[model samples]
Target: MSGIYIHIPFCKQACHYCDFHFSTSMAKKDAMIAALKQELVLRKDEFKGDTIATIYFGGGTPSVLTTTEINDLIATVYSNYKVIENPEITLEANPDDLSQGKILELSQSSINRLSIGVQSFFEEDLKMMNRAHSAKEAEQSIGEATKYFDNISIDLIYGIPGMSDARWRQNIQKALSFGIPHISSYALTVEPKTALATFIKKGLIKPLDDELAQIHFQTLYDVLTKAGFDCYEVSNFGKPEFYSKNNTAYWLGEKYMGIGPSAHSYDGKNRSWNIANNPKYLKAIGEGELPNTSELLSLTDKYNEYVMTGLRTIWGVSLDRIRSGFGEKYYVYITRQMEKYLEQELLVVTYGHLIATKKGKFLVDGIASDLFMINLG
Candidate 1:
């Protein structure tokens, strides 16, 4: 089974640290929606033999669209693609857009899951991030949404420049207070060209502390695991049945089609992405063209990606699968690389899977990179 991801490339306002493609203006929303539906129609054959197991509405802010508009897109998917019965349909929303009325409307629609962007429950943090919602709105939105949807996820950011350990603990406690089943949290990283990076460079904001972020991640894992949430992936914590199927599929290397500007798609061996510019994407789709670029994956490309994604999750690299699937040389290289980490207790092989140890969880990315199949043809 595969999935389809629809990128809603419009937001009411830009967040300080975000570099995702989106327009603050709603000027072309109607046309964009039409182009999205058209793109789905144009690409349906790509998934002709695969059943769509999840339909994810990710975004700049999917909640900005009306319920009718969202349903129309779903209807288009249903009409064009082979979707599973009771597929996981997720809508990524912002707290400000999830008012009581909007929540009720969405609950009654085909959308079964809601991933709300509640970056923080602190006023100062919200102000620094330029999130459009207040602390109260973040709390209130989740409270209202819980009344309607049980499969809900909220985003939380940690390691804000001035966020203390006590404050980060408070954020976790506050989220648990709402009985949210799933939480996706990440450290605040200053991406190049984002406002956060500029502010740091200008000395208007403190640069991110990697050491602090690691502390926050450990705190997050400990607290959530104690609360009976699974650290299925480094950044995602979910209860038994609440793991995000869409994201899990991606991590597992399943095929998925991404629709809209700057969205990406991957088949078993090839990957593609749409043009990032909105006007160009719309015009190309209107003119019966797929404005995208593609690349066929080399064996090394596939191996490196698998190692990178695998080590970041509870499902570690399968040494047997690696040896069998990627060949003896790759298996040997990885096992040789594994010796040092295993000695440090940063990684371990249990039941034939190479999993990251608790101490190494925060450092998995760097470790995975070190184990990458670089300079190998």
Candidate 2:
């Protein structure tokens, strides 16, 4: 099965910690939508051979698009691609965009699921991150969204340095009380060139401590797991039947077509990404060029990707799949290295699937690297 992703490259404001491709100016909004539709038609046959099982509208902020825009985009994909019956269509929305009317409109659309970006439910954290939505709006939006949609997933950010451990517990409690199905919480990351980084350097904002992040992470796991949500992937938790299928497909290295600026696509044999610059992308695509770069995946590179993605979630890399797909020697070496971690309580082997233990989930990158088959040649 394949997936389709559309990136809506526009935001109402520049968020302090956001490095995502977006423009505060909506000058090119209409043109970008037209260009995105055109790009879909231009590359119609890229994944035409596979059945499209999922379609994800990620952002900038997908909810910024009007209901008419949302409908039209879905129409284009259906007209151009082979979509499966009842596909898991998801939209990454922000709280400020979700009103009762908009939620009602979304309920009638093909979007069966929503991934709401409700970073926190407190005004202090909202201001700290410079998020466009207020805490009241965030809470009300979740309530409103659930009235129309049952498969609602809200995102929360933790370890903000401004939010204390007690406050963090309250955040978790608020989400749990909301009765939402899925929760994809994250530790605050200080990316280079983002406002958070600049502020920390200027001493205007405190930096996130590793110890604080660790504590927050552990607290999140404990709270969510006890609340009957599976820690299906690190940083993602879900109640019964609420895991994100679209993201799961990506982590599993399933083929998908990404249409828009700064989006990436993978087809098992090759990987590609579009130019992040909005104007450049629109110009190139408008001129009938694909406006992207591609790379053929080598055996070693593919193996590394597999290890990296698998270790980050509850599904650890399957050595059997590696042997069949990569080769015997590489597969043997992967399991051999994983055996070392297996002894250290970092990974657990159960039902023939090696999963990272709770401890291992904390340092997933390191464990995945140990099992990774690098291109040392």
| Model 2 misplaced regions, further than 4 Å | none
Residue 218's lDDT within candidate 2 is 91
lDDT tens digits, residue span 147-225, model 2: 8888999889987886788999999999889799899988888989998899999999987888888888899999889
Tell me, by lDDT, which candidate is best.
1
lDDT of 2 at 111: 94
TM-score per prediction, in order, is: 0.99, 0.97
- Write down the lDDT of every candidate, Cα atoms only: 0.95, 0.89
- Superposed Cα RMSD, model 2: 1.3
Give lDDT tens digits, candidate 1, residues 146-182.
9999999999999899899899999999999999899
Model 2 lDDT, residue 236, Cα: 90
lDDT accuracy of residue 119 in candidate 1: 88
Pairs of colliding residues, candidate 1: none
